[model samples]
Target chain A: MRTTHVGSYPKIPDLPAPGRWRTAAEKLQRGEITREEFRRVEDEVTREAIADQVGAGLDMVTDGQIRWEDPQTYFARRMDGFSIDGLQRWFDTNVYYRQPVAQGRVAWREPVTVEDYRFARSHSPRPVRPVVTGPYTLARLSQNRYYPRFSDFVLDVAQALNRELRALDAESPPLIQVDEPAILQHKEDLALFREAAAALLEGVRAPVALYTYFGDARGVVRVFYELPVEVVGLDFVAGVRNWEVLESEGFPQDRRLGFGVVDARNTRLETVDEVLRALDRVSRFVPLDRVDLGPTAGLEFLPRRAAKAKLVRIAEVKRAALEVTR
Target chain B: MNGLPLFPTTTVGSFPKPPYLLEARRKRLRGQIEPEQLRQLEEQATREWIQRQEELGLDVFVDGEMYRGDMVAYFADEMEGFAIAGLVRSYGNRYYPKPVVVGPVGRRRPITVEWFRFAQSLTGKPVKGMLTGPYTIAEWSFNEYYPTRRELVLELARAIHEEAVDLERAGARFIQIDEPAIHTRPDEDFDLAREAMEIVTDGLSAYTITHVCYGDVPRIYPRMLDLPVHQIDLALKNEDFALLEVFRQHRFTKDIGLGVIDAHSHRVETAEEVLDGIRRSLEVFEPRQVYVSPDCGLKTRTIDETVGKLAAMVEGARRAREELGAG
Candidate 1:
């Protein structure tokens, strides 16, 4: 449950670079702007945020989730068989482009888009995580709209994304991170999550780090240990005891383990020493090369300034801690 | 005695305590004032809140949660097997380190009656017996103990259920279980949440209600159709009124506590806007199943804003009733 040495955090010091538009998202519900207009603003704002993170100096950098509407939303847009009609009111905490439960057979109406993602990759020479909402998470979260079974819809969406990821693989850097935040919602879904995960990820050749946030991984920490995935991410903030489960459940030592000790949703910054203490504890489970670092969840919920400031500290402290301690 | 109509219009449950009462309660908890004195102060605040709503001609009123602690923390303490960790600095000096849920909860004593009685005693209005729903209590706590999140919630639900029966036995007629956490449910787990909810609220005798906001109604839809609660108090003011058509399609039969006022906003909503909201609600929901209320709670709002908005909501409901010839 504790890190013995320096571990990974979304130590990335940048945000998404400035750019332009494509799909619809939950932002449309907020009436902040039209979907097309939002795409452009977000693309650019994302660059600014990433620049800010890079300016701060940290380890790995992502487009700060610049390409998609939400983790699951952009993926939904790529495929067409599902209708946006059945989604319950947008999400309760964070909004997403949700599809309602149908016959569970998920089909894509449109070809998944990726130009803006390549645009994000173009932002810097730094190692960036090409983020994709995991196919299992996407299918699991969306309503099939017409499908009869959850797995059927989930697997279909997963297979399509595998194709997308494989294409993404042909074009860009090989690292693709799949966010499966919903996996923590229940225990029963852990095995099913692994199964569905294995499917969507079947053809992709990149190193995959499956991520879950906001709650405990108590149910499926074991499935994660055995899954064919290259890495696994666990939330350590609100999910106060997920680490204990991981320790008890036993994850593979060779696979990369993403330790999320930073509080992404809250504004208060933890002292460098405090974070180092957490990192040190996580290191106990895996060596530095086998661990990645990041917040417990997305940096979206925190006010932009707070999130930026937090990343600043994360980047700085990580450099000092890793250099001296490791 | 049954005190109110099913799924009545009321606050989600916190009221800003008058400075003096808050000071006194702090003093009382610190062993300064006697329980009787604290009781008097709560009753006084409850009287004022009730009178304010009565003056607005509200059909049902709450004592504005004059007696409970902060909504999430109160229930967090009663949860079973949680090690009350020493305070973790949350935001500021207002230190509230939650108890880690390490095991199952078995309620040993009553938690919210003294204030419910004091409020009901002072008013002729029907008072709401409010409690935080299970899903919320689990979500708000450090969920470290349970084998799974669902089991953790079911334990909390059973505990809340015991409280509901106690309130009903103690002359309470209506109950509202606030569940803003439903908004946080993963898009895929709506039915899992509903399943847990049904188990927790299985046998409550009074009209049970759930208040949640800001999610696609469909995430909870059709699935919510099966919950044990008789009514759903939801937020609608921030979104366009047309967003409500989904509920109509589902033929949701439960009473709907239509939030005519946006709780997150402080600007006093005009009567016309309020009426438009009520009208929009009526377009989709039958009048009998509709009860006018704020989208969420008033804790984040000022006293004046709360009063002003409630007044606006009541006036709008009256207009709708008259226009429909149901008055």
Candidate 2:
């Protein structure tokens, strides 16, 4: 089994002093430092994040999303026809994201995350997966003033993001992850999500993983499997009902399973036996080799130390699973 | 209520602590300073904030919540059956030690009453007793003990009920229980929030207020009025008072703590802007039904920003009252 991060590692390292990234960000806001100077500090932290993932023995890693303010604004700020607005709570967590307001038909201006992916790929020994906040989630989370219908807005966002995905695909990364945690909240939007997903992955040549978290995707699991993606990631911790759905309906053998066994939202670490038990159950349908073990959601919800420890635990689980299989 | 002005001005609790107090808090956390030393500084900061409010000509006052950290964690730290956990992100570049409920939760004693009494003693104006609502405490915490959220919330409601009663006994005229997490899951959890609030506000003599900010306000608009409180404080300025349209559609049933200044922005609002906000609010709410305040807590802003925002808010309220011929 391979181990990987869903997306987003903690920005701050386990340090006594305030993190340099935070300090530099404040300095940049205050005009005390140039944008170039602040970006250098961000680059340093990005390197550290990739190193952290590599040190934990993950097969695939990311840039840790250290430079991102939050998932929504990171893409919304870069794209056209959107304005970043006030802070809104992100799901049930204590964390908040700046809500994106769509003023007109959304369109992709240029590649947003390609350079970051290149930076991560250059710095890491492990394969780096470029993660994009999915169009369905972007449309769901945003306030739309331009579109007459919600479907129109979502499809437009999907068409816009398809360009970004094509750009990332050109990099020839291991896999691309599209996060649509908002889908589980609105199950009826599956058809619309399918339309958007189709548009988003239209010309992308790289293998893609569609990941959902924060809640169960039992209602949309079948629809999720129907998508033209190589992998389907679901949260087994917060989205426990996905387990029941998996046991009853069974997973498609053709698609790889992104087994999210680690709880990224909570500080509690899972033991090897606990992870092994879950692996045994999931391995019934999807073979162990075809599964990617990782946390349920982004590790940004956790402290740096706990997030690192969780990563180490996932690596340990992978080793233990290998031993059990042997 | 009769003693208040036409457009009564107040804060939604929490002002930015001075640099020395922030340093003292840090020292106290590292065990470099005694509890009494920290308490003294907290008192000093509270006194200064109360004096500042009086000078700014606000009708009502809050103790500024200088002795607290995260609103949920503060009560969790004082109450039984809770252990503070590792850092969790609250927002952009903001983290707080999340509280985990480990056992049967109970309040050993009044959490904010002593702070309320201290602040009240320093001022002649009525100081609002501030407490984080039970729904918020339960929603924000990691519950390991309670089988259901309702049970834990009700237990917390009972615990906060004790605190509210004590604050009323200590001569608090207004008690603001903040439930910022109420609107997070409006479909499933809103009723539970109202039930828990009823348990806290039942038979309490103090004018009750619930402060909710930065969530799906439109989703829970008229239904939020079902919350058993005398007033609902909202972050209206940040949303450009767009909620007024909803209020106009479904008549607002309770007093509104009209947010006239944006608390999160570093740029201080002009008095004209604040006045414009107050004027827009008056279109939907009567002057007496409106209470002027900042959008939310001022702890996120610097001391200068907080002062500038509040000064502008007070000036705008003054101008609004004059226009209404009630100054």
Q: Which is the leading candidate under lDDT?
A: 2
* Candidate 1: segments with Cα more than 4 A from true spot: A1-289, A292-326, B1-9, B22-39, B78-80, B83-97, B186-189
lDDT per residue as tens, model 2, B1-327: 749887888999999999999999989979999999999999999889988888888888999999999898999999999987666766666678788888988888888888888889888888999999999999888776787889999999999999999999989999999999998788888889999999999999889999998788888878898988999999888778888999999889899988888888899999999899988887888778998899899998998888888889888888998998888
By summed lDDT, which 10 consecutive residues of candidate 2 chain A come out lowest? A13-22
Q: Against the true structure, what is each candidate's TM-score?
A: 0.57, 0.92
Local error of candidate 1 at residue A81 (angstroms): 32
lDDT of 1 by residue, B214-313 (tens): 5656656766767778888887776556458787687768888887787867788887887788776766777678777887778667788888887777
> Per-residue CA lDDT of candidate 1, range A108-185, in tens?
454354565576668855666666777666766665556556666667777777777776677655467777776776
Q: lDDT per model, in order? A: 0.66, 0.89
What are the clashing pairs of model 2? none
